[model samples]
Target chain A: MAKMHVKMTVNGKAVEALAEPRTLLIHFLREELNLTGPHIGCDTSHCGACTVDLDGKSVKSCTLFVGQANGAEITTIEGIANADGSLHVLQEMFREHHGLQCGFCTPGMIVRARRLLAENPDPTEAEVRFGISGNLCRCTGYQNIVKAILAAAATLNAEKEAAQ
Target chain B: MIPAPFEYHRPASLAEATGLLAELGEDAHVLAGGHSLIPMMKLRLAAPEHLIDLQDIAELKGIARTDGEGGGEIVIGAMTTQHELIASDELARAVPLIREAALQIADPQVRYLGTIGGNVANGDPGNDMPGLMQCLDAAFELDGPNGRRRVAAREFYRSAYVTAREDGEILSRIRIPLPAPGHGFAYEKLKRKIGDYATAAAAVLLTVSGGRCGSASVALTNLADTPVFAADAGAALAGSDLGAAAVDAAVAAALAAIDPAADNRGPVAFKQHVAGVMLRRAIARATERATERAAEQTV
Candidate 1:
């Protein structure tokens, strides 16, 4: 098999890499782009640790091939911060709320939660639980993870209203 | 684990895709979302020499309700993702069961990447859409070297990992006739947890008129080699008030039709019981909704 030249916008940065058609998007992000925030918890799609925002929707990076994602815009955990390198609201909430213990699934959780809030800015407790059901957090027992997401949604919504 | 080496081809049109498939022959496999296929490739269960990516084919996208000779029909592109199906209000209004079932498939992330075409075409017994499509009486449109054709969803599956879709043909679109207005629908699935395949699932679409069942369709998932249509079970509820007797007969018919081989879920008898329970729940909810719809129309 021949390596294909793949180009895409990752975290608002243009990146071009040569990868085999069999190379997964998770490996491409970790190895080529050096975006290690998206951890590969389970190679299979069961664990959502490799979740990334692809074209505005959350997708498991481990299950997608690099060649198939060519020419698409992608956002991993690293892209969720502010332009001046400040923690995004979701990250801040995670720290304030103690959303993680071992921190292995933190990046994926924060990344997916940001998208969830973006899609449903005012999610209820049950809705928040269901929205992030795909992303697992074994450490916090999901109590604080859910709290952090809800807190982030409130803060983000408040900021939006204040800006107006 | 990484997948084995394979050449990737992105065809821009259906003709190009079919040409690639016909040219590559047995060594080629169509890639639609790749949620299932990629994992299989990683496990070395499927090692195709050529992988035809269908993402670039513009024609294999979108959802629209078009008028046909028989009535209204919802035509969904094969590459439409599960998320797309859930988000399409046209489809939701025409056939709400599609949304009900799509929400139960995998999870939000998987739903974003998983395509309905791949779900129905892959012949995975655990997939939710095939059984629901049978209940909706949807037709799959295929494009191959021999040109275009349609196959009824009820008759599409031959066995697990086998279907009526020909080797060189690509499922281009799924056409579902709009259910009669005031139709009731529900998809009841009993899985161990979220994102898990159903222990047993049932889809029901029914229309009630004058306190009696006018028509009904029931389909079961992961209870057999293929999605079971449960024709006898559906017949049992037709022209009845959806009474206790009618519901019991339908459940019995559904239990008899299903041939579930228990692996981790439960024993054969346990799965059969679960399947019957799912059918009864689906039928009850569907009938209730149908009766409500019938009452609303009279006003």
Candidate 2:
């Protein structure tokens, strides 16, 4: 396999990795870069377990080749913490609401949901369901996840208002 | 499931991409978002020796519309992601039907990674874009060693997973004319679950003028080897009253037009039933929206 040189900013840090031509972003992040926060549930793009923020959108990293993402800014679960190392609102919400059990799909779920809430802060229940439809949770019928997201939206909005 | 290895080329320009594709011939595939292709590649269903990545081709990456050119056509770059398509206010207002379809595609993650070009270029009967694209009467601009050419959406798909594209050709843009004022369109898809492939889907576009059906188009997905355009159903509605009786006739014809095959999803009979139900619902929803717009126009 031929090798390729890729340079990009991942999770607020500049990272460079040399990889094969067919190296998927998931494998590059996990094996090459050792950023295993992004899990790989289905490498075939069916499961959003490999979700990560690329450029400004939440995308399935498994579908992306390392070369395809050259120079693009990316965010993963590892970046969701504040400079003080506190969990992000979505992370906090998921934990408080018991949004996950078994936790295999939690990272992708929170990453995807954070972007969703960013775009639509006050989305209805239907919108929330559609927003995170890509991220599946076999455990917990998802009622609690929805509740957590709604709760996070309220907290974020209140915090913004308070700061203003 | 890891995909079979392939040589990857990230061409910066359309000319370069087309030239590389020509050099690689049938063994080459264009990588748009790869939400569709990568999965097939991993399943070992498609093993191209060369992948000409279009992500670097900046020209094919955004949605552009111009209201200044008298009446305008929405020109969506071939590699525009589903996220971009759904985000465009122009698409939402000028042709909300496309956004309606975009909203139901896969999920936020897949939509973020998938491109509209890949959705249509894959030529899968199960894909939601084809039926809607066909109903929009869209056109494709192809660039190759022979220069650029255009193909209408209706003529783009030649067979199962095959298109009219030449070995070296690359789709540059998808162009759709502004739909009629007060036009109402809806896309209805029934899927097994979130992020799962839709079992059966329908895209309906039509305009009701003064209580009469001025024009209508009904297209079905996953009911055939391609997005089947039910001509008789639209023919039965065009220029007629879009009342209960006319809708009934069109629905029946549209259902009869679909020849669904048995798959893991369900039996052919079940698919046919769902197709009819979805078609009916899409038409009804589209009509209801049309009525609301017409009422607004009078105000």
lDDT of each: 0.92, 0.86
**Which residue pairs overlap in candidate 1's backbone?**
none
Off by over 4 Å in 1: none
Please provide, for model 2 over B1-299, each residue's C-alpha lDDT reduced to its tens digit, 9 standing for 90 to 100: 67788888888999889888878889999999888788788788988988888888889988887665657788999999888898899789889998888888887887876888988888888888888888888898888899999999888886678888777788899998888888988899999876666788888888887877789998888888878888888888898778778888988998887778898899988988888789889888988888888889999
Candidate 1 local lDDT, B222-286, one digit each (tens): 99989999999899999988999999999999998999997898989999989988888898899
- Candidate 1 chain A: worst-modelled 10 consecutive residues by lDDT: A132-141
- The positional error of residue B56 in candidate 1, measured at the CA in angstroms, is 1.0
Assess each model's interface with DockQ, reporting 2 decimals per model. Answer: 0.91, 0.75
lDDT of 2 by residue, A1-164 (tens): 67888999999899987887778899999898888999999676767899999998898888888888889999999888989999999899989999998888898988888899889999899889878888878898889899999999999999999999
| Model 2 lDDT at residue B178 | 83
Candidate 1 docking quality: incorrect, acceptable, medium or high: high
Best by DockQ: 1
Q: After superposition, how far is residue B95 of candidate 1 from its true place, in Å?
A: 0.3
